[model samples]
Target: MYRFSFFVALISYSTAINAQQIELRLHGCQTKSDKTYFCQLSNLGPIAIPAIEYNVTLAEDGRTFPWAEHRSGQEIAGGLEPGETMDLAIQLPTLPLRANEENVSISVELLPQYLPPPRPPADAPATAKTFANQVEACFNRSTLSSAAANGAIDVNVTGLKIQKVKNYVTDDAAAEQLFQAARRAILVCMSRNGTADVDVSLRFDGSGVHGLPSDY
Candidate 1:
């Protein structure tokens, strides 16, 4: 009966996750070369997961740009490992001229799909248990890190806004760890930029949770 109960719980949890939504955020753009548009793709919320892939494309009107090459999918294997986020940067090919003065309709889709489980109650045991385990989980993940492993790309749009997304963390230690790394990167980039402060809001979502919860 114990094994049966555990099996039942596993099935129930998997089903709930399969219905969850994958959140893809277009933080904004950075011009790398004279003609390349380096777009920032962020897997926002529930938590990052490994083996997840994304396809991004840019279009003008109903037609796609031939010059725009869809780069290879970025994989966040090793998962977000709870209270962790990965930032990826992709530089898309740009035409000699801007396609449209109006905002270009850019689309990003997560392959293999994602469904976030419904939010658990504030007092749920899983929430309480996972809270304390996040940092340790991240540490374990440090071993799985690829030399190429980098978090979602930070976006800096000239004269517009700075959409600064805070790293997800369950505690101060985890938060500080992420902050120090980010600060170092920003300092390096600041030497080439005009300014760093751009007003933006905090938008939270499941990084790429799979499936929805039964309750929600």
Candidate 2:
């Protein structure tokens, strides 16, 4: 009975130790050939994680912020052996315009290439990932695209116009989610009046921060 109890305790300890032995760290690096930027994903864990083939998910409250966009909900990494890391050459997603600021975090899971990627709904278009970057860029560019508490959010684009409204409730939560999901503006508001609609106009410029022209 003494030997059996010791064995059980050992097994439990092993399970707990291996629960999340995979460690991930993000470092900003540039490639030598083209000088383009990439977020380096390092695996400083006991086990090897497949590179580019692994599954990655961002925690909204996580402190590590990545600048790349996940066209699909997840990305596939190549392989990362213990202490090995790989760089993802994609641009990061942008945070939405909001009254309150929050943090972002990331998590990755290993996926061997032998398995197939997840399939979208049958009715979904193939080009869904293409707009992901555009959506993120738009999120930061629009001030009026988000709401303001205790006052009106007046945003005027260079060539675009803006309209004013009174006393809009400024909830940053929903807009932040919308920025992660789409390329347009989503208003989260509260009001004293019964009116529920306000017209907002904004544009996503590809020449702003992170969207700068190559010639320059």
Candidate 3:
């Protein structure tokens, strides 16, 4: 009997060691006229959590009805780390009964998926024009198209656009090839300089690339 009890205790200890502890606290919630609620979800744990699964219910008139069941992870650029919080927009299905803020209840479960890899320290800040010039130089050296050289560059926080001064390569397929090459060059430049990622668009025609604002 003593041996059996020792084994049971060992098993219990192991289980406790492997168990994941998580907490969910709601800060504030707002209900819209269309049965949508904006709420806050917080992660109160020692480690990062990749995904959050939650069920929201409405308790009204002594009866409970399921409002929403949602799983979110990728909404956040990186996984939700310890002590981090995210905004959640939850919509409820229309029902004959009416529910208000006081009647809502939520239960959250944390999924222990793989943790995100550690990121390198950020590089020193540089102006958008400087980054754009570096990318243009890299593209000019990497591509075979002469028209790609000395292209006008526009860079913003989210996007980069390059327009050739002269359309030397008129073929659509050849222009696309140049664009692909330019894309690779931009990626390499970003890695070398430790710059943030941005979308790249190429214009073979002399016209400037549209859609990006000049004020940026």
Candidate 4:
């Protein structure tokens, strides 16, 4: 009977140790909108966990502040292993607490699911993955033409004369050409606006031009 009791006590101790082993920390929190708060949570342990269940509660009745309703949840993607942290950008949907209300303390709890060890970061190469594709799409006239052909960049022109220029910018030379063309158009518009020669020159940088008929 003594031996059995000793075994049960050992098991209880082990369970307590493991239960509190998982660490929980709040990275930061930001108010997104009157109704939403973006709470960022980070796991600062050296274990890759499959899932975590967390809860957050705010303090009530500080300085007689109005009661604010809060809803909390997680926006977790996959799991985090040891030495790797997970950033959960949670969007809390809640009604805004009135001003001059009580200061509130938020509480968070995390439950982690143990998984296999994490892979070394040295094996993963960080490169500009999207820039090349974006550049290629921008420079490929065929792609741009196809996109225009598909009405991706639709323009609804009514009164003004419309011109569609398809400039392929693959190399630096072509890019320079595109920039020059854009600059030339801007300069022409600026000259027209400054001299007031045109009836109406709308420079969209918060500038308006009223050209007199005799000024030109």
Candidate 5:
């Protein structure tokens, strides 16, 4: 009886872990002359995702221009399977001649195909501060000493706003590495805390990370 109980407990734990593991990667994005941008998304997790919702923003000098948003499940025939990739194309309004590639930013949100089992009441509630702390800690632990030696990386949290820093390091590869590391840490922390959405900003000052609240 004791052996059977232990086996069942282990299986349950494993299932929970698998259910919470979801990873989606944005391979690349490019703009076309027709005011449309195309991007490739890949499912890097064990589970399949039903669909994706994404927002594309065009901004310059802290001003945002009108842009189109898309939300659809029909893009994926059945679902996005593990190691599978799908293409996304979004149309935008005509932009001012001054608008350039640097003004474009894309944010993506994945929709799970199935809901995971409910968490027990004992589970701690998710908070933005906690999430930010987790991200900072994870990034620090994952980054190399040489890469982080010259610049300081800080993560701060407010209501729902999150800030990330860049432009301090001269090494493009190292900067990208830090950005990816912070992104992965945020994803994991959000998953554990059941955080649905967050607003992320990138700052060029090279100071540190900060968070604020969003209307969403």
Candidate 6:
């Protein structure tokens, strides 16, 4: 019954992963543009998950503003890949006036609708530095490059904290190769921003490709 035992072990392993929790993290909010709030969130665990569904709030002077509950009731997001960081913006009518005030704090709460998963480990660190624009551009370019063969690959890039770069793609080999191109883009883009030598982290789905680990 060697084959029967192997099949039993396989089922047990599948059960374990499905029972595993999807990890998430919400970084701090920083003032972006003129009175707008922006933040970064990441998938810190071993699995590549879908877009995060969240609601945001601004707290200061004893007042709070909720983004999803009160504004834009519906959700629209493409989820963060394993080790990928997703950039989010909080919208509010009074932000233009309130943003000027110092010590403003933002709170982003995840809703149950997306069956939002538990957060990252308590000891897991958080970062705020981002290359959202560059990420969007790079993903777009990579998708375009892969289009001829793989059609439009869906992915999101986040967590570009200085000296720490990471992203996730459907195809590790193609994405790793394509995102290396993204790394060069970051080099040029960051150089203009007065930074250099940012290390990168990449992850993919499955037990990973043969001879291809998640990090590079």
Q: Against the true structure, whose lDDT is highest?
A: 5
- Candidate 4 global TM-score: 0.33
TM-score of each: 0.31, 0.25, 0.34, 0.33, 0.36, 0.34
Which of the two candidates, 1 or 3, achieves a greater lDDT against the reference? 3
Candidate 6 has an lDDT of 0.38
Which has the higher TM-score value, candidate number 3 or candidate number 5?
5
| Candidate 3 stretches greater than 4 Å from native | 1-17, 64-75, 97-216
- Over 1-216, each residue of candidate 4 has an lDDT whose tens digit, in order, gives 000000000100012113323444555555544333444444555444444444444444444542333333333466554456445654432424453223443444443322222121232111212221222222323322211211111011112331222222212333344334333443453344442222221111001111111111
Candidate 3 overall lDDT versus native: 0.43
Query: How well does model 1 score by local distance difference test?
Result: 0.35
Worst 10 residues of 1 by lDDT: 1-10
Cα lDDT for residue 157, candidate 2: 17
lDDT of each: 0.35, 0.30, 0.43, 0.31, 0.44, 0.38
Off by over 4 Å in 1: 1-21, 34-43, 62-71, 93-107, 113-216
Q: Tens digit of lDDT per residue, candidate 2, span 1-216?
A: 000000000100012112334455656533233222245666666655432333333334433554332432123355567677665654323434431222433333332121111222233222222322233333444443222211122122121222221111223442333232222232211122222332222212222211111111
Worst 10 residues of 2 by lDDT: 1-10
The C-alpha stretches of model 4 lying farther than 4 A from their native spots are 1-20, 61-75, 96-105, 111-216
User: Model 1: what TM-score?
Assistant: 0.31
The sequence of per-residue lDDT tens digits that candidate 6 reaches over residues 94-142 is 5444343354444556432122222222331121124434333333343
Clashes of 2: 18
Candidate 1 per-residue C-alpha lDDT over 1-216 given as tens digits, one digit per residue, 9 for 90 to 100: 000000000101123113333354444455444334444445554544453444455555556443244545544556554344455554444543645524454444444432222343344244223322331222222322221122211222222333333333322343344444433433443344433442212111222111112122
